[model samples]
Target: MARFLTLLVLLLAIDRAFACKPEQHFNANFSDTADQLSGTEAGNLATWVKSLQNDYSNHDLFVISSYVKNASQPGDSAERRTKWLKDFLVAAGEDENSIVSAGTQVYKPENFFYTKITPSTLIIEFVPGCPNPCCLGANPVKEK
Candidate 1:
């Protein structure tokens, strides 16, 4: 019975480590040239950050930005937007080390028939992993 219980616990831990969490999609459009986040957007982000802290504290947060290529924009605009998002997440109390920006991806239409163009977007994903302090190279055993 003890052996069976130990196996069950091991299986549960393995399942959790491999579990896939849903990725969140949000519009990355800023209202002005300054790339400022509006009050509503800021409020929503803060709430999301709090949820991450409360529910997925053991997971690593990954942020990815996608944008449609435009001739008028600078080439590095997408990367800049991605960095901005990471900065915002860090500012909202998320551990900067736990947050990883996958950088920007250029959006490609599946075919010529897709006429609707979408604005830039941010994708947020959380994956199970070592939480901060432990993940930051600090010895967990010594911290206690």
Candidate 2:
């Protein structure tokens, strides 16, 4: 019984060690224009990216942009916003290959229970390792 308990504990620890929990670093609303990040927002983003590059140099960065169809203009797209952010980060000195991005469309119901719709938002995450063991050598970035 003691040996079984020890084995169970070891298994749990191993699972936790390899778990792919991404740390959210940024979240905010972006304008319709891809490069329309405000001065303050741009400053903050640059600082965070620099810090990530300097402090956590070994980890990869994941960025996600989510937008509601009804909240954005007819021509706006989540992919454009996400790509803009990735470009901005690269220009700011972050390695282009170390960053991954995803754009997602969010659906919201119009019912009274969910009246408030979220605006177009960008989220940045820090990914430490591949989420699955099978893809250990390949660091594929998927939406979190």
Candidate 3:
């Protein structure tokens, strides 16, 4: 009986480590507000999160719902998340040409803010500037 129990525990550990398989999706969801996220530990990949927001904002088309497994760990900040997502989506079958990256400042004032992405956070406010849609650059930087 003791030997059998030990074998069972070993099997369980192995199963947890190798539980994930191809074609098996583990779904996750995030709230509409991503500036300050409040969700499960299974946070979403950056692209998926953005897709959800874009869809809500009527900016993106729901062409394909690609299945992508979670990374071993969630990214620490938006920049990290974006980079991780670009690589993750490509690995999960997204066309390289179809992918683009953009980020909005957390809270800063500037016409062309965030030239560097070393900082991990993503919720800075924009600096006061000329009030013009074309002049204000709210687009996130791409890494392709």
Candidate 4:
């Protein structure tokens, strides 16, 4: 019994360490954008978004993922990432209608700079708190 308990504790700790801090990851920084969510910084914000779709999740609460950035990339696009996020959420057994995407391109005309990043955000509503949410209605994920 002691051995089992120790193993369980160790497993739980490992999971937490790897999983993203849901609360902070979905923060309404009102300043964060998706373009800036990547890389090692931002607490690995992009990965946190991915963690929400973990199969082991069982929280009866809504999740809102917001993407932000500092500037716009002429070739930058969130469509691909957005699709991945949707797929991730569905795979995690989350309802397909809870993902909320919001943000606008940064106006950086005539700026050919990789550093000219345009922020964006992706909000996944795990347990929606809003009435008449504009996103797709929550529904069980359909196995493909």
Local lDDT at 83 for model 4:
59
Scored by lDDT, the top model is 2
Candidate 4's residue-wise lDDT over 1-144, tens digit each?
Answer: 999999999998777556623232343222233433343434454455456444324444544433324344442345455555556556646566655455334434344254433234344445423221222247433221
TM-scores, each model vs. reference: 0.56, 0.62, 0.25, 0.32
lDDT tens per residue, model 1, 1-113: 99999999999867754663344444555543435466887688777667656644465556555464555556365666667777887787667887776655555656323
Per-residue error at 35 for model 3, in Å? 15
Best prediction by TM-score = 2
lDDT of 2 by residue, 1-144 (tens): 999999999998778657745464676457645545777878888877776555443555565656655645442566666777888877987678867756565545542244333455566665544443223346544432
Ranking by TM-score: 2, 1, 4, 3
For every model in order, what is the number of clashing pairs? 0, 0, 13, 28
Question: Residue 64 CA error for candidate 3 (Å)?
Answer: 16
Supply the global lDDT for candidate 2. Answer: 0.62
